[model samples]
Target: MIGFTLLIALVGAERIAELTVARRNRSWALSRGGVEYGRGHYPGIAAAHAGLLGGALLEAWLLDRPFIPALGWPMLGLAVLAQGLRWWCIATLGRRWNTRVIIVPDLPLVARGPYRRLRHPNYVAVVAEGIALPLVHTCWITALLFTIVNLGLLRTRIRIENTALRQAADTTPASP
Candidate 1:
Protein backbone atom coordinates (compact mmCIF):
# COMPACT_ATOMS: atom_id res chain seq x y z
CA MET A 1 0.00 0.00 0.00
CA ILE A 2 2.82 2.36 0.83
CA GLY A 3 4.52 1.49 -2.43
CA PHE A 4 1.32 2.03 -4.34
CA THR A 5 0.78 5.41 -2.73
CA LEU A 6 4.32 6.44 -3.59
CA LEU A 7 3.86 5.24 -7.14
CA ILE A 8 0.68 7.27 -7.53
CA ALA A 9 2.41 10.32 -6.11
CA LEU A 10 5.22 9.93 -8.58
CA VAL A 11 2.74 9.54 -11.42
CA GLY A 12 0.97 12.68 -10.29
CA ALA A 13 4.25 14.56 -10.30
CA GLU A 14 5.03 13.28 -13.76
CA ARG A 15 1.65 14.48 -14.98
CA ILE A 16 2.35 17.94 -13.55
CA ALA A 17 5.62 18.04 -15.44
CA GLU A 18 3.89 16.97 -18.64
CA LEU A 19 1.27 19.65 -18.14
CA THR A 20 4.01 22.24 -17.70
CA VAL A 21 5.64 21.17 -20.94
CA ALA A 22 2.28 20.98 -22.67
CA ARG A 23 1.31 24.45 -21.55
CA ARG A 24 4.56 25.90 -22.82
CA ASN A 25 4.21 24.07 -26.09
CA ARG A 26 0.60 25.13 -26.43
CA SER A 27 1.52 28.74 -25.94
CA TRP A 28 4.32 28.50 -28.48
CA ALA A 29 2.08 26.82 -31.05
CA LEU A 30 -0.85 29.18 -30.58
CA SER A 31 1.47 32.14 -30.97
CA ARG A 32 2.38 30.70 -34.36
CA GLY A 33 -1.29 30.31 -35.45
CA GLY A 34 -1.79 26.74 -34.42
CA VAL A 35 -5.46 25.74 -34.63
CA GLU A 36 -7.03 23.38 -32.12
CA TYR A 37 -9.50 20.69 -33.08
CA GLY A 38 -11.79 18.38 -31.16
CA ARG A 39 -12.30 20.83 -28.34
CA GLY A 40 -15.70 19.28 -27.70
CA HIS A 41 -14.22 16.03 -26.43
CA TYR A 42 -11.41 17.57 -24.47
CA PRO A 43 -13.34 17.87 -21.25
CA GLY A 44 -14.43 14.29 -21.28
CA ILE A 45 -10.90 13.14 -22.00
CA ALA A 46 -9.59 15.17 -19.12
CA ALA A 47 -12.26 13.83 -16.82
CA ALA A 48 -11.47 10.28 -17.77
CA HIS A 49 -7.80 10.73 -16.94
CA ALA A 50 -8.56 12.35 -13.64
CA GLY A 51 -11.02 9.62 -12.88
CA LEU A 52 -8.41 6.99 -13.66
CA LEU A 53 -6.04 8.33 -11.08
CA GLY A 54 -8.59 8.94 -8.38
CA GLY A 55 -10.46 5.75 -9.07
CA ALA A 56 -7.29 3.71 -8.88
CA LEU A 57 -6.46 5.04 -5.47
CA LEU A 58 -9.99 4.76 -4.17
CA GLU A 59 -10.51 1.25 -5.48
CA ALA A 60 -7.23 0.02 -4.11
CA TRP A 61 -8.03 1.38 -0.69
CA LEU A 62 -11.71 0.49 -0.55
CA LEU A 63 -11.18 -2.97 -1.92
CA ASP A 64 -8.23 -3.53 0.39
CA ARG A 65 -6.25 -4.85 -2.53
CA PRO A 66 -2.87 -6.26 -1.86
CA PHE A 67 -0.10 -5.95 -4.39
CA ILE A 68 0.48 -9.25 -6.04
CA PRO A 69 4.22 -9.53 -6.40
CA ALA A 70 4.23 -11.10 -9.84
CA LEU A 71 1.72 -8.74 -11.37
CA GLY A 72 2.90 -5.70 -9.47
CA TRP A 73 6.53 -6.04 -10.51
CA PRO A 74 5.74 -6.44 -14.21
CA MET A 75 3.16 -3.66 -14.16
CA LEU A 76 5.64 -1.34 -12.50
CA GLY A 77 8.12 -2.07 -15.26
CA LEU A 78 5.47 -1.43 -17.89
CA ALA A 79 4.51 1.86 -16.23
CA VAL A 80 8.15 2.97 -16.39
CA LEU A 81 8.36 2.01 -20.03
CA ALA A 82 5.20 3.95 -20.76
CA GLN A 83 6.67 7.07 -19.16
CA GLY A 84 9.78 6.70 -21.31
CA LEU A 85 7.69 6.43 -24.46
CA ARG A 86 5.58 9.44 -23.43
CA TRP A 87 8.70 11.58 -22.97
CA TRP A 88 10.09 10.33 -26.26
CA CYS A 89 6.94 11.50 -28.01
CA ILE A 90 7.16 14.87 -26.32
CA ALA A 91 10.83 15.26 -27.24
CA THR A 92 10.18 14.21 -30.81
CA LEU A 93 7.26 16.59 -31.27
CA GLY A 94 8.91 19.46 -29.36
CA ARG A 95 6.61 22.49 -29.50
CA ARG A 96 3.99 20.58 -31.46
CA TRP A 97 3.04 18.32 -28.59
CA ASN A 98 0.07 19.25 -26.41
CA THR A 99 -2.72 17.69 -24.39
CA ARG A 100 -5.15 19.12 -26.88
CA VAL A 101 -5.27 18.38 -30.59
CA ILE A 102 -3.60 21.51 -31.82
CA ILE A 103 -1.76 21.62 -35.12
CA VAL A 104 0.40 24.34 -36.53
CA PRO A 105 -0.46 24.94 -40.17
CA ASP A 106 2.08 24.17 -42.93
CA LEU A 107 4.43 22.28 -40.68
CA PRO A 108 5.42 18.92 -42.06
CA LEU A 109 4.42 15.87 -40.03
CA VAL A 110 7.02 14.70 -37.55
CA ALA A 111 8.46 11.35 -38.66
CA ARG A 112 11.31 10.79 -36.27
CA GLY A 113 11.64 8.83 -33.01
CA PRO A 114 8.60 6.70 -32.19
CA TYR A 115 6.64 8.55 -34.84
CA ARG A 116 8.70 6.78 -37.50
CA ARG A 117 7.23 3.46 -36.44
CA LEU A 118 3.80 4.38 -35.06
CA ARG A 119 1.41 7.13 -35.98
CA HIS A 120 0.04 7.54 -32.43
CA PRO A 121 2.83 6.54 -30.15
CA ASN A 122 1.72 8.93 -27.46
CA TYR A 123 -1.62 7.19 -27.20
CA VAL A 124 0.23 3.90 -26.91
CA ALA A 125 1.94 5.30 -23.87
CA VAL A 126 -1.39 6.50 -22.51
CA VAL A 127 -2.93 3.10 -22.97
CA ALA A 128 0.05 1.39 -21.41
CA GLU A 129 0.00 3.61 -18.37
CA GLY A 130 -3.73 3.39 -18.05
CA ILE A 131 -3.48 -0.35 -17.79
CA ALA A 132 -0.18 -0.76 -15.99
CA LEU A 133 -0.62 1.84 -13.29
CA PRO A 134 -3.79 0.44 -11.84
CA LEU A 135 -2.68 -3.14 -12.23
CA VAL A 136 0.43 -2.41 -10.23
CA HIS A 137 -1.79 -2.01 -7.20
CA THR A 138 -4.21 -4.79 -8.19
CA CYS A 139 -6.81 -2.28 -9.28
CA TRP A 140 -8.09 -4.27 -12.23
CA ILE A 141 -11.49 -2.61 -12.18
CA THR A 142 -9.93 0.81 -12.55
CA ALA A 143 -7.63 -0.44 -15.26
CA LEU A 144 -10.45 -2.01 -17.25
CA LEU A 145 -12.78 0.96 -16.85
CA PHE A 146 -10.21 3.52 -17.93
CA THR A 147 -9.08 1.42 -20.88
CA ILE A 148 -12.61 1.17 -22.19
CA VAL A 149 -13.39 4.82 -21.70
CA ASN A 150 -10.07 5.91 -23.16
CA LEU A 151 -10.59 3.78 -26.24
CA GLY A 152 -13.90 5.47 -26.88
CA LEU A 153 -12.30 8.84 -26.43
CA LEU A 154 -9.41 7.94 -28.71
CA ARG A 155 -11.75 6.97 -31.53
CA THR A 156 -13.01 10.51 -31.83
CA ARG A 157 -9.62 12.02 -31.10
CA ILE A 158 -7.88 10.07 -33.85
CA ARG A 159 -10.48 10.98 -36.44
CA ILE A 160 -10.21 14.65 -35.62
CA GLU A 161 -6.41 14.54 -35.64
CA ASN A 162 -6.26 12.71 -38.97
CA THR A 163 -8.57 15.22 -40.58
CA ALA A 164 -6.54 18.09 -39.18
CA LEU A 165 -3.29 16.54 -40.35
CA ARG A 166 -4.68 15.90 -43.81
CA GLN A 167 -5.96 19.46 -44.09
CA ALA A 168 -2.58 20.80 -43.03
CA ALA A 169 -0.80 18.61 -45.53
CA ASP A 170 -3.09 19.77 -48.31
CA THR A 171 -2.50 23.42 -47.53
CA THR A 172 1.29 23.07 -47.34
CA PRO A 173 2.95 23.90 -50.67
CA ALA A 174 5.00 21.21 -52.31
CA SER A 175 8.75 21.72 -51.86
CA PRO A 176 10.72 22.59 -54.98
Candidate 2:
Protein backbone atom coordinates (compact mmCIF):
# COMPACT_ATOMS: atom_id res chain seq x y z
CA MET A 1 0.00 0.00 0.00
CA ILE A 2 2.85 2.34 0.71
CA GLY A 3 4.24 1.67 -2.71
CA PHE A 4 0.83 2.36 -4.17
CA THR A 5 0.63 5.71 -2.40
CA LEU A 6 4.02 6.73 -3.64
CA LEU A 7 2.99 5.77 -7.14
CA ILE A 8 -0.04 8.00 -6.89
CA ALA A 9 2.10 10.86 -5.66
CA LEU A 10 4.46 10.41 -8.56
CA VAL A 11 1.62 10.41 -11.06
CA GLY A 12 0.11 13.43 -9.35
CA ALA A 13 3.32 15.36 -9.72
CA GLU A 14 3.46 14.52 -13.40
CA ARG A 15 -0.06 15.84 -13.80
CA ILE A 16 0.96 19.03 -12.03
CA ALA A 17 3.82 19.53 -14.45
CA GLU A 18 1.64 18.86 -17.46
CA LEU A 19 -1.04 21.23 -16.27
CA THR A 20 1.41 23.98 -15.51
CA VAL A 21 3.21 23.81 -18.81
CA ALA A 22 0.51 22.42 -21.07
CA ARG A 23 -2.14 24.79 -19.81
CA ARG A 24 0.10 27.72 -20.51
CA ASN A 25 0.64 26.40 -24.00
CA ARG A 26 -3.04 25.85 -24.44
CA SER A 27 -3.78 29.40 -23.39
CA TRP A 28 -1.19 30.77 -25.76
CA ALA A 29 -2.63 28.81 -28.63
CA LEU A 30 -6.11 29.91 -27.73
CA SER A 31 -5.04 33.53 -27.92
CA ARG A 32 -3.99 32.88 -31.49
CA GLY A 33 -7.40 31.42 -32.40
CA GLY A 34 -6.13 27.88 -32.37
CA VAL A 35 -8.73 25.15 -32.79
CA GLU A 36 -8.98 22.37 -30.21
CA TYR A 37 -10.31 18.91 -30.76
CA GLY A 38 -10.96 15.89 -28.52
CA ARG A 39 -11.74 17.64 -25.30
CA GLY A 40 -14.57 15.21 -24.58
CA HIS A 41 -12.25 12.26 -24.04
CA TYR A 42 -10.07 13.94 -21.43
CA PRO A 43 -12.29 12.91 -18.54
CA GLY A 44 -12.15 9.32 -19.67
CA ILE A 45 -8.38 9.47 -19.83
CA ALA A 46 -8.23 10.89 -16.32
CA ALA A 47 -10.51 8.20 -14.98
CA ALA A 48 -8.47 5.46 -16.61
CA HIS A 49 -5.28 6.83 -15.05
CA ALA A 50 -6.91 6.99 -11.64
CA GLY A 51 -7.96 3.39 -12.15
CA LEU A 52 -4.32 2.45 -12.66
CA LEU A 53 -3.44 3.50 -9.14
CA GLY A 54 -6.58 1.99 -7.64
CA GLY A 55 -6.00 -1.33 -9.34
CA ALA A 56 -2.41 -1.38 -8.17
CA LEU A 57 -3.44 -0.86 -4.58
CA LEU A 58 -6.14 -3.50 -4.75
CA GLU A 59 -3.79 -6.09 -6.20
CA ALA A 60 -1.11 -5.32 -3.67
CA TRP A 61 -3.53 -5.79 -0.78
CA LEU A 62 -5.69 -8.70 -1.99
CA LEU A 63 -2.72 -10.73 -3.12
CA ASP A 64 -0.56 -10.05 -0.07
CA ARG A 65 2.18 -9.12 -2.43
CA PRO A 66 5.42 -8.58 -0.63
CA PHE A 67 6.82 -5.34 -1.92
CA ILE A 68 10.36 -5.94 -3.13
CA PRO A 69 12.22 -3.00 -1.77
CA ALA A 70 14.89 -3.29 -4.41
CA LEU A 71 12.41 -3.28 -7.33
CA GLY A 72 10.27 -0.59 -5.75
CA TRP A 73 13.22 1.73 -5.46
CA PRO A 74 14.23 1.27 -9.07
CA MET A 75 10.71 1.63 -10.34
CA LEU A 76 10.57 5.00 -8.69
CA GLY A 77 13.72 5.85 -10.51
CA LEU A 78 12.15 4.90 -13.84
CA ALA A 79 9.12 6.94 -12.95
CA VAL A 80 11.40 9.93 -12.46
CA LEU A 81 13.01 9.31 -15.79
CA ALA A 82 9.64 9.21 -17.49
CA GLN A 83 8.66 12.44 -15.81
CA GLY A 84 11.87 14.10 -16.87
CA LEU A 85 11.39 13.12 -20.49
CA ARG A 86 7.78 14.24 -20.43
CA TRP A 87 8.69 17.69 -19.16
CA TRP A 88 11.58 17.88 -21.57
CA CYS A 89 9.02 17.42 -24.31
CA ILE A 90 6.98 20.31 -22.96
CA ALA A 91 10.00 22.55 -22.61
CA THR A 92 11.14 21.75 -26.10
CA LEU A 93 7.87 22.85 -27.63
CA GLY A 94 7.45 25.79 -25.28
CA ARG A 95 4.07 27.40 -25.98
CA ARG A 96 3.45 25.17 -28.98
CA TRP A 97 3.02 21.97 -27.01
CA ASN A 98 -0.20 21.33 -25.14
CA THR A 99 -2.18 18.56 -23.48
CA ARG A 100 -4.99 19.18 -25.90
CA VAL A 101 -4.53 19.18 -29.64
CA ILE A 102 -4.55 22.92 -30.19
CA ILE A 103 -3.57 23.84 -33.70
CA VAL A 104 -2.64 27.37 -34.56
CA PRO A 105 -2.07 27.89 -38.22
CA ASP A 106 1.15 29.63 -39.35
CA LEU A 107 3.13 28.31 -36.38
CA PRO A 108 6.41 26.45 -36.68
CA LEU A 109 6.72 22.74 -35.88
CA VAL A 110 8.86 21.83 -32.90
CA ALA A 111 11.86 19.78 -33.99
CA ARG A 112 14.25 19.89 -31.08
CA GLY A 113 15.24 17.63 -28.19
CA PRO A 114 12.91 14.61 -27.84
CA TYR A 115 10.79 15.97 -30.67
CA ARG A 116 13.72 15.36 -32.98
CA ARG A 117 13.76 11.64 -32.17
CA LEU A 118 9.97 11.10 -32.02
CA ARG A 119 6.96 13.22 -32.77
CA HIS A 120 5.37 12.12 -29.55
CA PRO A 121 7.99 11.71 -26.84
CA ASN A 122 5.48 12.73 -24.22
CA TYR A 123 3.43 9.73 -25.18
CA VAL A 124 6.52 7.61 -24.89
CA ALA A 125 6.91 8.72 -21.31
CA VAL A 126 3.25 7.98 -20.76
CA VAL A 127 3.56 4.42 -22.05
CA ALA A 128 6.71 3.82 -20.07
CA GLU A 129 5.25 5.04 -16.80
CA GLY A 130 1.97 3.18 -17.23
CA ILE A 131 3.66 -0.21 -17.38
CA ALA A 132 6.80 0.41 -15.34
CA LEU A 133 5.16 2.01 -12.33
CA PRO A 134 2.63 -0.75 -11.70
CA LEU A 135 5.20 -3.46 -12.20
CA VAL A 136 7.13 -1.99 -9.31
CA HIS A 137 5.06 -4.15 -6.99
CA THR A 138 4.38 -6.90 -9.51
CA CYS A 139 0.89 -5.59 -10.16
CA TRP A 140 0.27 -7.10 -13.55
CA ILE A 141 -3.41 -6.32 -13.62
CA THR A 142 -2.84 -2.62 -13.22
CA ALA A 143 -0.19 -2.60 -15.88
CA LEU A 144 -2.26 -4.63 -18.31
CA LEU A 145 -5.45 -2.68 -17.90
CA PHE A 146 -3.65 0.63 -18.15
CA THR A 147 -1.80 -0.41 -21.29
CA ILE A 148 -4.96 -1.67 -22.98
CA VAL A 149 -7.08 1.37 -22.27
CA ASN A 150 -4.35 3.90 -22.78
CA LEU A 151 -3.32 2.32 -26.06
CA GLY A 152 -6.84 2.63 -27.34
CA LEU A 153 -6.97 6.23 -26.23
CA LEU A 154 -3.58 6.93 -27.72
CA ARG A 155 -4.59 5.43 -31.03
CA THR A 156 -7.44 7.88 -31.34
CA ARG A 157 -5.46 10.74 -29.89
CA ILE A 158 -2.41 10.25 -32.06
CA ARG A 159 -4.46 10.26 -35.22
CA ILE A 160 -6.13 13.48 -34.25
CA GLU A 161 -2.93 15.20 -33.18
CA ASN A 162 -1.05 14.06 -36.26
CA THR A 163 -3.74 15.39 -38.48
CA ALA A 164 -3.66 18.70 -36.68
CA LEU A 165 0.10 18.83 -36.81
CA ARG A 166 0.19 18.12 -40.51
CA GLN A 167 -2.39 20.76 -41.16
CA ALA A 168 -0.44 23.24 -39.09
CA ALA A 169 2.69 22.43 -41.02
CA ASP A 170 1.04 22.87 -44.39
CA THR A 171 -0.29 26.26 -43.49
CA THR A 172 2.86 27.52 -41.76
CA PRO A 173 6.12 28.47 -43.46
CA ALA A 174 9.09 26.19 -42.85
CA SER A 175 12.00 27.34 -40.74
CA PRO A 176 15.56 27.15 -42.10
Positional deviation of residue 36's Cα in model 1 after best superposition, in angstroms = 0.5
Worst 10 residues of 1 by lDDT: 2-11
RMSD in order of candidates: 0.7, 2.2
Query: What tens-digit string does per-residue lDDT give for candidate 1 at 1-176?
Result: 97798889888888899889989999999999999988999999989988988999999999998899999999999999999999999999998999999989889999999999999999999999999999998999999999999999999999999999999889989988
Per-candidate clash tally: 0, 0
List candidate 2 stretches off by more than 4 Å. Answer: 173-176
Candidate number achieving the greatest TM-score relative to the actual structure: 1
- In model 1, the Cα lDDT at residue 72 comes to 94
Global lDDT of each candidate: 0.94, 0.82
**Model 2 / residue 43 / CA error / Å:** 2.5
Cα lDDT for residue 119, candidate 2: 80
lDDT of 2 at 159: 89
